[model samples]
Target: MRILLAEDDVSQAESIKAWLEMDGYSVDWVERGDHAILAIEQHQYDCLLLDRGLPKATGDDILTHLRKHQHNTPVIFITAQDSIQDRVGGLDLGANDYLVKPFSLDELSARVRAQLRTQHKGTSQILMFGSVSLDPQAKVVKLNSEIVNLTAKEYQILYKLMQHPERVVTREQLEESLYAWGDEIESNAVEVYIYQIRKKIGSTMIKTIRGLGYRMNLDQT
Candidate 1:
């Protein structure tokens, strides 16, 4: 998953970023609220880790602006304030979860998982399309009960396709999901990944549209 962390505390940000990255999340961080907003506007994110107090703009202000613009992305306020009123205020401002500073990394990870689970409308932990199953959090993919070997990028493509079974997720959208800020992307990277996925999974599992993009063929599933 992709996440945006809006925090000014250098040590704290680095710690959280490193931890989340280790947990298989693509994380981009900005130290200022305006930069956070700009990042939000530029790319898609699975979640937002926002600090209540920020430079130039407050986290509440950022959340308010996002809501005003109809961005329903899940937000977790990572702040030092842990009072009753403070918690209520953050929730009222549309935060899906809240984590106070001096918090355990495991707790933060748990809350993030919870938010993602709630965001997912699926009824299963393993996303399935026919005999193929994917444990996203575990970064594992199985073809009919047999574990399929996949590189990180290959897993990313398959997971993206599985998430939107039969739906056409454009090349640009897939590229964004596969890459983080400042990461170099090859022109044929998407095609290469698709080829790798097809070789690992069944060829019929994915279909390429001439003008559009790739779509998972779940009808046979």
Candidate 2:
């Protein structure tokens, strides 16, 4: 999944990004709330980790704009504002959760997972396609009830395809999910990952639509 973090603290942002990336999530960060707004407009992020105190625009302003436009992306306020009133106010502004700074990265991860679960609704986040299953929180993929070893990028690509089994996932969309700003992506990087994924999963599961992109074959088993 993709997450956008809006924070001005360089050290904290770097640490959070590293931790989330290790947990198999693609994270893009912006130090300014204006940039955060731009990124939100351009990308379909699964969640937003926002700091209320931001340059150019406040996190509250961004959240209000998001809600006003009816964008339902989950938002978690990760700010130093620890007062009950502050937390209440943030939640009132449409944030799904609130986290105080100097908090545990582990707890932060748990909170993110909570928001994701709520977004999925009905208490289950498992994604299934035919005999293949993926646990986003656990970062595990299984084929035929057996574990499948896959690189993070491969899992992300497969997850994207599985998320929309009947729709074509374009190469650009997959690249956006797998990479962040300033990351160097090779010309044939997507193709290479797709090839590797097919070998690990099955050859007939992913169908390449010429002149377009790829789609998951729901009928494949």
Candidate 3:
């Protein structure tokens, strides 16, 4: 799953980012609430790990913006506030979960997975379409009981495409999801990755929409 982590403490943010990546999640880390808001505005994330006392803007304010704009991405407020009223306030601002400071990495990771399940409408962690089964948590893909080897980009492209199954995923969306904010992106990078994924998963698994982009072949799976 893709996540946006909004925490001002550099060490804490890096530590969380490292573990989330190790746990098979693609994470984008930002220290300021403004950056977090910009990231959310420009891209989509499975969840947000937000620190309430953020500089430039507060986490609650950011969550309020998300709610006001109808961005339903799940949010987990990580703050030092541990009171019931504080928790209620966070929840009222649309946070799906709340974590007190000095919490365990294990607990945070577990919460992230839980939020991901919610994002998928509580679907099983094992994503499926026909004979293909994808375990996003383990970064594993199985095609008819056979393991499919894919590069990082290939897996990301396929994962992004699979998230919406039959719906078309535009080239811009694929590109934004695949890379971070400042990476030098190639003009044909999305197409190249799509081609590579098709070669591995089978040409018929993805359909190109003349000007639109690609979608998973839902008819077969």
Candidate 2 lDDT over 93-192, as tens digits, reads 8999999989999999999988887787754478888878988767789999999999989988998888768999899989999888877999999999
Q: Which wins on TM-score, candidate 1 or candidate 2?
A: 2
**What CA RMSD would candidate 1 show?**
2.8
Clashing pairs in 2: none
TM-score of each: 0.83, 0.90, 0.77
lDDT of 1 by residue, 86-190 (tens): 999899989998898899999999998888777764544788888889986666899889999998778878888887786898899888887767668899899
Candidate 3 achieves a global lDDT of 0.85
Candidate 3 ranges with C-alpha deviation above 4 Å: 122-130, 133-140, 145-155, 163-168, 183-196, 207-212, 217-221
- How high is the lDDT of residue 189 in model 2? 99
| lDDT (Cα) of model 1 | 0.88
Model 3 lDDT tens row, 1-221: 57899999899998998898787567898888898899899888878999999999899989999999999999999999999999998998789999999999999998988887666654647778777778876678988889999887788788877877978989988877776555589999988888887787788899888899888887785
The candidate scoring highest on lDDT is 2
Between which residue pairs do clashes occur in model 3?
Answer: none
Model 2 residue runs over 4 Å out of place are 123-128, 135-139, 218-221
Which candidate tops TM-score? 2
